[model samples]
Target chain A: MLGTWSDGPTKSAIVDFVGRVTTEGPNYVVPEERVAVFDNDGTLWCEKPIYIQLDFIVRRLAEKAAADGSLADQQPYKAAVAGDLQWFGGAITKHYQGNDTDLKVLAGGIMSLHASMTVDDHAALVGKFYAEANHPTLGRPYLNCTYTPMVELLRYLETNGFTCYIVSGGGRDFMRPVTSQIYGIPPERVVGTAQNLKFEGADGHGELLIQPALDVFDDGPEKPVRIWSRIGRRPILSAGNSNGDDEMLHYSGKPGAAAMRLVVLHDDGEREFDYTAGAERILDHADQFGWTVVSMKNDWTTVFGD
Target chain B: MLGTWSDGPTKSAIVDFVGRVTTEGPNYVVPEERVAVFDNDGTLWCEKPIYIQLDFIVRRLAEKAAADGSLADQQPYKAAVAGDLQWFGGAITKHYQGNDTDLKVLAGGIMSLHASMTVDDHAALVGKFYAEANHPTLGRPYLNCTYTPMVELLRYLETNGFTCYIVSGGGRDFMRPVTSQIYGIPPERVVGTAQNLKFEGADGHGELLIQPALDVFDDGPEKPVRIWSRIGRRPILSAGNSNGDDEMLHYSGKPGAAAMRLVVLHDDGEREFDYTAGAERILDHADQFGWTVVSMKNDWTTVFGD
Candidate 1:
């Protein structure tokens, strides 16, 4: 069912689990209760060099910097204008290394971009980018960079009576427009970090303005909270590829009820860039908890869906 | 398709809208875009005496008061212990009158009740209430009180390739368990006021605690904000029964795209309720906007689905 997956233990484990759960037996989970959540960037699609969302943001920031000299002097805008990929990726790395100072500045800079725009305007901007922009290094469409094995895994789960959801730390509004076509998941099924939405116009004909702040950051410990809030049911299966997914992976598995957790290891440097910068903690836990760790180098026959 | 709806303009209008939108023509909307949102309280069920969730809350408050002497002296707790339904309903009335003084007190009392438990425990309490509690004034089970016409309307829309969601001011977690069985809308499709959820446990084995604070109040103008955040698309069809639904109804209908908004008027004293306490503003705008006003006396042949 997972066509891009090389015949291996990772594939066999997932297939066996689905068989037991869907069968009318002790492990049977009703369709309504069969919830599965997957992290977006590194797991479903490539987040190498930097996140796809970050690339989109930096490009937009650079354009604004070219027009406004004052904005060009700002830290993120300056980095964006110069195309300093290290600055953006380094902010994330610094956050993981117990320093959130750079990350806070980076997050604030991102939120400021949405402050002046309505959700519709922001979504249109993102939609235009998705339609026109290609991956900088990969030289392909942004949608083409999504992992083929992971997409196949999602379809296989759906075919076996599981509703798959995209739970990421990326902007929810940013991902909703393309999630359905790209991942076969509806907009309502995609839960992520939310922007502050303000209701304008009194009694009728109101618009939701995106404020310069995040209402919720769906990462680390917050992932479990967002999952419970949005789904209202514990997921039967969860898959991710970073330290931020540790809580979600642990939350999905229980002692009695059969559950599965999968973590993708980005180890195929030839086909795809390989680095464990953000996934060190998660990989360790996967080993200790006996969670299925899919090695990209050995387990996937192809990388991108195309 | 809408068996419970009487043969009238209200029924005909809804049917025609669905037919035009579902068929292949200029007004046709793809199944993915056929999003429908419904207000849960008065629109979907009997909210005449009190909101179903509010009634559930009063019962729990009364139970808490019986055990603790200190809590019994409080305003809402005292009122709950005395079985004072007027106090509970009046707080909502005060809110509509633009004086949120009592509503603030009433909301704080409710939030305090949830602060002590995890989501699983709070859900169990709500589930038990749905299973065992009866509507006080109606003298029937809580599930038995949901409007037959609305339930039929939900099914009819779903049958015609529309996805229906419950967007209410009531607690999102409180309504989730019964929404699936009572209204044919699953837990994930239910969007309402959210209680803040906190994740406990570090790297693995996490539990989400229901914090004693509201993350979002999905009512009034905020209804449209919540709708956009969750659905990410303006609904083609929306329904509600009170002033809280004004923005949502207006938001659904644009200049051209073809949308329908249904507002239920509780003017049938015999079968259900006859009142205009909280619906004065919405009813006034309903006439102005040409939004279809469904009179319970004339539009429905039955009340409860059973």
Candidate 2:
């Protein structure tokens, strides 16, 4: 049997709309061209004081700096290890300046750092990191901080024949390596920020070059543009937790027969990180634009994996 | 019910291995990793003296040149319209060389080439070209020249839960426009040669920048290497019709609990083009490989769509 919606006015309204557009029940509809896109970071998971991936990158950078004398002298590298995250955050881009050295050196360094390890080993490292890490403000296990209601929304759309894709500003490949297992969305269906890679043969085996420098950051407006180019179609439904996904929701809400754009409002202080203002990532846009505002506080009975 | 394979020395060996590895009656069923990779042109469909995509490019060039005088003076552009198949063919790479035109330009050019036309229009144009154009030697409709048995083989593997991907030397996006409908595979799952694409836009709605050059060509050893990079794992089953796919087959055949590589041998004369002895693509590495050879002459059945 299909699962019931954990009751509430906001949840009921959103679920009812999704149900109408899905390929079954009363509405039993949607054009064959219908598509849906979702943002990954705060909308899909938890991004409070800082994005989880940025933390991973900082950690990776710290390890590299400790091992490599040359890297230790670098601005972001040195700062990352010293726990000076402010300097390490997006500051590496300024340091790289005009040359391709940052990307080349960083990606190469990162690959060499973990290239020899098998898939199992990589998973274990990630698992250990997640277990020990804590969000600065929330002071909770990072892994247990995902937005549960948004996940169910994703499932509802998919069940209705919507081709759901994760379009985020985070690393595309990194998200792909684990999203399918975690969210039931396959790697091919996920698109996000990417590092350039090249093909080569190493030690009598084929390998790909994973560059460290940023390629495309699927943030804000870039979200919708990348969606059109990569997906070749506009999505009929879109959901996001912040301003990073604004363009995506706008694109999805483009003039069409039927469309839906939802902004997940973090109103639940007890269950999840509650924020009233967040630099226009989510709250500001919700009031300005007439989009479905899902109140995490009132709409969800659960916020993370139980 | 499982389909029957003719009793043969080689066939028996392959079937026995699969039988032992499957769920119903299995010894060691390696679950969730049954990846299969395929070579699109010549293997999945038909590629004779020239590729189908080349014709599309040439036609598009002709149309573009007709509209823009700048293109007419171009070496490749001039050669294309004059019906100088040889000169035009030789300039295939040159057309894409250093042409850092943005996605909008590339997409606009592509969409405009056959603008406002229905799917049938596109299909008919392709069919008309295939019907009239003559291969360098085969002298039959390109579509009529496909390997019949191979199509069955493709579906056969898919039925067994093998996720088949088209890993070919052809343009990845070019094939994506049509292959899924024709071959029953989705666009996201297909991987092939690519031109560099740039993302642009406040919301990522920028045009796809097709560099006037090839970004990556999925051919020769690059086939298997690209497959691993894109898919992040080696295929358990592989099929190819030429030396271009030899690396892929070899990679698939590498010792695992159960692995299989099948090579399609174009040996039929009366039913289709039979020129294996001098076939430049598949013959080069035929002697060194230990793959299951599906002989067109000996293999049961038809050769093309009736």
Candidate 3:
């Protein structure tokens, strides 16, 4: 089913887990409990040059800075105006290194980008950007940046009994607009960091306004908590490419069946970006837990595919 | 399909909405966007004697007060120890009257009941309570308290290619364990008030501990916001029984297709408690918006049915 995947242990592990649970035996899991969660960036799509959401929000902040002198003085806004991907990348790298002082500024900037607008308006803005924008490094439409093998894996699982969900650390509203078209996952199945929404009922009409507040930063340890809160059952299979997904791997369906944990390693600088700055911890656990790690350079015959 | 419902405007409205949307025409909605959201308490089951979650939590607090003298001295805990349903009822009644000073205190007590415990522990407690507990006034097992007509309605909609979800102001974990068996709604489809969870990964095991804080109260205006956040699509059909559900009905699919908003009015004094203290605002909304008001006294031939 996963035609883009090379014949390897990583693909075999996924097949083995699906077969064990779907077959009639002790390891058999009911169809109702077959939950599959996936991280959006890096795992599903390209995040190396920068996360797509970051790029979208930066262009927005940069435009605002060009008009407003006050906004131009801000650190991230200044960085945004200059198109300094390294500064944003460093903030993320510092966060994985257990320092979030600069990451908080980055998060605040992201939140401010959508505050005070209706969800529909924000969704339309994101829709416009996704349609017109292209990956800076890949020179391809943002929607086509999703990994070929991963998309095949998602379709293959759904072809069986698994209901796949995108549980990214990106903004929930940011991902909701395009997820259905790109990943074949519906908006209801996408879980991510959220902004507080306030219902404004005035002049005899009700509209929900986005509040400027951080609802949940759904990364790292928060992933497991949010997954359990959104979907009460544990996931039978999970996939990710960074340390942020470590807790989710541990929280997969356990003690009763064989759970598959797929970790994708970007080691093909020729085809895709190669770096392991934020994935050290997850890589260690992959070895310790005997999880199947997919070498992007070797496991796939192609990078992006339909 | 809705056999329990007598031939009335309410039943006709539901049938008409479903027919217009499911059939191929200018008014037709695709099956993927046919979302239905339902309020858990009062709408699906009896909430007259008390909300089931309140009953469960108060009993736990009363037991704690029996041993802890400090707990017995507190206002709500003392009321819990004394089995004063009036105090809890009054608190709910006042909140609907635009006063939540006492409701906040009551909410604090509710949150504290699950604080510091793992989600699995809390779910197990709820499971045990639902198994053995009976409605204080209805004199039936808590699991069997669901309204027969509502169950038929849920099943009817599902039979017509609709995805049903339970969105409530009650605790998410509290409603999740039993919604599947009682309402044919799975845990993943149940959205409600949430407690922040802490991921405690120690001793080679990961457990989610419930933090003593209210994350989001899925009531009143928050209903529309939570509904959008969880589902990302406006519901074409919504059912509720209180003021908290008014916004949900307003937020139902609009500007394009026929939307069905079912407001259940408990006015059967013989078979159920007749009260409009908390439902006054919603009753006014039903009239103003031309929403269908399902009178339990006239619409149903039976209240609780399998």
Candidate DockQ values, in order, are: 0.57, 0.24, 0.57
Per-residue lDDT over B89-147 for candidate 3, one digit per residue giving the tens place of the 0 to 100 score: 88988888988888988888877777899888888999999998988888788888999
TM-score of chain B of 1: 0.97
Write one digit per residue (lDDT tens) for candidate 1, span B29-106. Answer: 999889999998889988868888888889889988888889988879999999898998998898988988888888
Give one digit per residue, the lDDT tens place, for model 3 in A1-306.
Answer: 899888887777778889999999888988889999999899999997888988898899898788788987787898998888899988988988999988889878777777889888998999999989998888789999999889889999998899999888888989999888988999999999888888876322467788878877889899999889888988888998899988888787664456888889999999889988899988988888777799999999999864
B22: Cα error in model 1, Å: 1.2
- Over the stretch A3-54, how does candidate 2's per-residue lDDT look in tens digits? 3335766666666666677646544555445578888877888876567876
Q: Please give, for residues A1-306, the per-residue lDDT of candidate 1 as tens digits.
A: 788888989889999999999999999998888999999989999888788899998998898788888988888999999999899999988887789987898888888887858778888999998999888888899989989889999999989989999999888988988998899888888889987888775444556788888888889889988888778889989999999998898889554689999999999999888888888999999988788999999999999867
How many collisions between residues are there in candidate 3?
0
Q: What is the C-alpha lDDT of each candidate?
A: 0.87, 0.62, 0.87
Judge the docking of candidate 2 as incorrect, acceptable, medium or high.
acceptable
Top DockQ model = 3
Better of 1 and 3 by TM-score: 1
lDDT, residue B69, candidate 3: 87
Better of 1 and 2 by lDDT: 1
